[model samples]
Target: MSFIRGKKVGGVIYYSEVENVRVNGKVVQKHIRYIGRDKDNPDHIPIEKVHFGYIATRLMQGDLSPSELFGMIEKIGSHVNRENLERIGLFYDFKKNSFSLSLYRKRLSGNQKDAEDVKKG
Candidate 1:
């Protein structure tokens, strides 16, 4: 599995995807992809550099702070609301102020194919 790794060089923090592999009878960490540095806003990483899966994971795990979460959702333009989040297999509990992956992800109710299939033999 590949995960994000961070390093500081010349006063800039660089992020990259790294993975472990065996070579020469020894296991070593290898850099998979160079994700870039956030020069201006340290808190804001380029959205293109990060995968959607990571964002979803953070949101579900409550790893992101309120401002960070809202900023990320706005930057991603993912339309994260109760209805949309639920539609995409995520749960947002307003009362508890929590986000998580839904156990009972509901399927789209008005699919044309499903309707047609039901009418056929």
Candidate 2:
């Protein structure tokens, strides 16, 4: 379900890890992680970068609770995206136009504010 995709643009080859998913009965390919360009050694990918898809998979498997998941997301900040969760096997019900994480909002919101306050101080 996951594979490498490569594209060449102006002599630079870029690659990404992609996953296939079914959306509205249509199979769509989504990018998981930007693996970097051929010009740059992919093996040397930065340590600071966290793959949200992998974390999402852990959360889906219940290996991490929703509060832990949200904490990781807040730590990663902008790097998190809906696509990452979908690639990790989450699905969106377009008819409902909703996600199920509302159950976690109450659990995580308070802790998140405390974390923010600690960071600010």
Candidate 3:
């Protein structure tokens, strides 16, 4: 697992992957934070201040998009009238791949090149 730092915006927390780290000898896939609504005990927190573990967990899973995640909470009866805040959070999800801003950028550039190469190949 890797620990990453994210920046906070209005209300949403944005987690930018820091480094690839190992946790309990397992590789972390992704990292994220909950912005609106408490996943575990929705009633425990106020409607505006809700985000909980569930949202964070979902982000880690990479299944739900930031917008969709918040929409789900609202659909379920939670109310959050705000934009996605860019809050900084920690991320520790990496197995073999070391996650650094430079590395990530390089990989993306490489991927684009690879795609071009594939067309020529």
Candidate 4:
């Protein structure tokens, strides 16, 4: 169950790497990945990670949407198995762009303190 639309909620996601707690609002979706043995025809499993990040280049100019962020996370979930993927949707406000691994586009940001606190209990 997700409390993204109406319910006022915030909780911790136990990813493979750093555990991250949602600060103000919960993500809009759950199980947003397509990973498995099959590359062409893949299967998705339920996964949650915190404080993870990946590198992504700015393809279009616009604000990173919640869904897009989640999808991006899912895509690279395997790479950052132990860490939160942060660079994929990480975008620069002025340039209206996102992050990238191969290209130097923007810096992926996250609140490590919050993630640690949440993991500590």
* Candidate 2 wrongly placed segments (more than 4 Å): 43-121
TM-score of each: 0.31, 0.34, 0.26, 0.20
lDDT of 2 by residue, 30-53 (tens): 866555553232321212213434
Ranking, TM-score, top scorer first = 2, 1, 3, 4
On the 0 to 100 scale, the lDDT of residue 56 in model 2 is 50
The list of candidate 3 runs beyond 4 A from truth reads 1-54, 88-121
Best by TM-score: 2
For candidate 4, lDDT tens digit of each residue in 45-67?
33322222322222343565646
Candidate 2 similarity to native, TM-score: 0.34
Per residue, candidate 3 scores C-alpha lDDT tens digits across 2-114 of 45465667874554444554689986555433222323221122222134445556768988685785586567575543322333232333553321110011123667768
lDDT of 1 by residue, 1-121 (tens): 9987789999868877789999999999997545445322122223332444676778689786655755665676533333212222344446655444322223455685487468774
Candidate 1 C-alpha error for residue 39, in Å: 12
